[model samples]
Target: MTSRPRTLIAVLVLVGITVSLQQTFVIPLLPHLPTLLHTTPANASWAVTATLIAGAVSIPIVGRLADLWGKRRILLACLAFLIAGSAMTALSASLGWFVAGRALQGIAAGVVSLGISLLRDHLAPHRLASATSVMSTSLGVGASLGIPLSAFLAQYADWRLLFWTAGGLAALAGVLVLLVVPGRSRPPGGRFDPLGALMFSSALVCLFLAVSKGGTWGWTGGVTLGLFAGAAALLVLFGAWELRTAQPLIDLRVSRRPQVLLTNAASLVFGFSMLISSLVFTQLLQMPTAAGYGFSESMFVAGLLQAPGGVCMIAMSPVSAMITVRFGPRAALMAGASVVVCGYGFAALLHTELWQLLVCSALVGSGIGLAYGAMPSLIMSAVPVNQTAAANSLNNLCRSLGTTTASAVTGLLLATMSTTVSGHVVPSRTAFTTVLLTAASAALLALVIAAFIPRRRPATTAGPLLATPTAVQRHEPRPTP
Candidate 1:
């Protein structure tokens, strides 16, 4: 591989990591937000919710914009939002300001999808699989590593320093991208679909708000039900509009291809499967030993235990790429999902020791690394070159939807299935077992879905050159097998 591709991949992966950091780093600070900002707990929770809603809204918009404009340009714009938002939060004293800042930070969520698209545009066919694998794995790597790092910082340093650190990292990433990443040549020409973007964002916000807050506000309460109703109505309208629009924000026709549709379906299930381990193990490790099946570990220790999974994810990236190269991405995805099912199966049976949890978490992470890596390759192959960013963004959005659903479902399970221990209610062993089984079932479903992805034709010759107007006009050199 050339040094330029290596440098480009490293920079993009770093940007991906920074974006993931923003997703989880604030989690450790949630409990302290109410006191620090002098607000009610209910209000403080918006710090998290705002980010989630903003991210969902921005992903497709940014992806479409990246395809229309330049990916590198859109990437830099996202980092600027990250830097500015982090700075606002760092300096804020009021809850409103913090939530606003968090919402701004959320806009950076499209970086991973954009990075994958960029790789498709630039890399040679032989190098694309591995480069995209490492890029995708960076998401899990950042999420797992950020938890312990943020916990340590929140414990020892001022909480605002976390945002300050995030800001610094975003700034650094922006500068590196500016220096190393090459700009795209044939930027797709299309008018921005404002109506579609508006409808989509509005519907998503309602859907996400209802899902994320249904437990807190009674699930059947008028507000929650109203939000759900509104989301459904808007989504129907949005779908109709997208179908009619000349230059749609998301190309519905392309997205409906069997490969794209099934890959996205698998992504959602895989996402749920991935999040269950994080939700289950963290609580399992922290419960008091008096609760029969508890480890009573500190938050830091629990996070540290999960760190090995991140390592396994990074280690598996190359293997995933190899699998994608040898067997098509369809086989690699099924293999990954099968591995996840095995991981969850192990967790369901073995809950006695710390080492067992570590092993289980690592197993799940390895599967996720492989599955996540394959998704982009599957989506990109099915869509036209210009639609790569938007398609990947939609896939990423599906995963987010899956994770949100997991949070709601698991929260309800743990809340209802608990035992009392010295005035505190803790999740019972049965509850934990049920969650593991549910996660395993989700992975099994993903495996079934992966089985249906269309098989690729045998390679008779080298793959096509990078898709660009210049390359189209004058035949570019294909990579030698």
Candidate 2:
């Protein structure tokens, strides 16, 4: 296979770094957040939730903007938010200030989804597959490095420095993305859907706030119930509005395609399994030494153990692309989801040993890498080129929704079922076991959806991927079979 253009390759790597760094950058400070801000643990959770919620709300908006205006322009706009937000966070003296900074960091998530959409537009088809895989896999890379690096810095220095570093990184990426990437075909003429944006944003915040704070709010309390009701009603209104608007924020018809529908359903399952199982590992590792199956590893060691999974993901991405090509995206997706089920099954049975946890998690990571790599390809195939950014962003929103569900459900389980063993009220073996079962169930659900993916066999004869081919060399030239 011929190499991809150097500029194209550099842009992918930088975007990957930019996206990954945002999520993991705050891991090291999680433990100290409450004390640092002089707030309750429940209130401190908003620092994390703010960023995730922002990403969930902003993704579709920024994505649609990228499709309408230009991908590069939207990406630069996102980076500007990241730089400004991170710098503000570094200077903040209170919890409210920190949360503001974190909310801005959500814009970085737009960079990730939009960057992936642009890959389909600019890169040759063969090159696009692997490039997509690498960029998607960067989620794992950013997460893995961000945790350990943040821990080391937080342990030795002030946590505020973490945001300072992130700000600098964002500025550098903005320069690179602007200078290196090619411009789009042309800007489409359309105004931003302000009403849809408002409705969607309000709905997302209410739902996420309820889920994030439910642990402390008492599940049946007035606050939780009110938020849930408000979110549900707003989302219903948002859907109705989108359906009636002359120019809808999201094109609902495109989402009705079988390939797009199934890929998104599978993405939700993937998100649930990946986050829940990994968080389970964190709880298991941080358990007291007295627990026969537990260890008291520092935050650094915990991050270190998880690091290999990202490595495994990076190593497996090319293989994932090859599988997508040979057996079509449907079969490859089933294969990936099935593998993830096996990973969760092993976790349930093998938590007695550290080596078992690592091995099982590596299997899970491999499955996630493969499945995530295929999601964008599936979406692009189903939607028009003009809708690539919007469709991909919606797909990402499903993953986020799944993750939010996992976090809330697991937190509820652990909080309600706890046992005091030697004056420390840790989640009992029963609770942890229940979490494992729930994670396994999520994988099984994904596997079932993956099974229904419709087949779209490629044409037997080789031809150019697009109607008019560019000058860049494609990676997979037709075999001389």
Q: What is the TM-score of each candidate against the true structure?
A: 0.94, 0.92
Q: Which stretches of candidate 2 lie over 4 Å from their true place?
A: 1-6, 457-481
Best by TM-score: 1
Taking the tens digit of each residue's C-alpha lDDT, what string does model 2 give over 1-481?
A: 2134557656766766666677777865777988898988777888889998998889889888888899888888888999999998999989999999999997678666787777877777668767777777776667766776777778878888888888888888888887777775577656678899899889988988888778788779999999999999998999888777766678776676676788898888778877775577777787887765578787777766777777777776777777777776666567777777888788877787889889877887788778777777677666666677888889888887788788888988987888886788888777888888888888888889988876661331232122222211132122222
lDDT of 2: 0.77
Score each candidate by Cα lDDT.
Answer: 0.87, 0.77
- Candidate 1: Cα lDDT at 480: 28
Give the alpha carbon lDDT tens digit for every residue of 249-344 in model 1. 997877887888999999988888888887888889888998878989877777677788789889899898998888878877998999999999
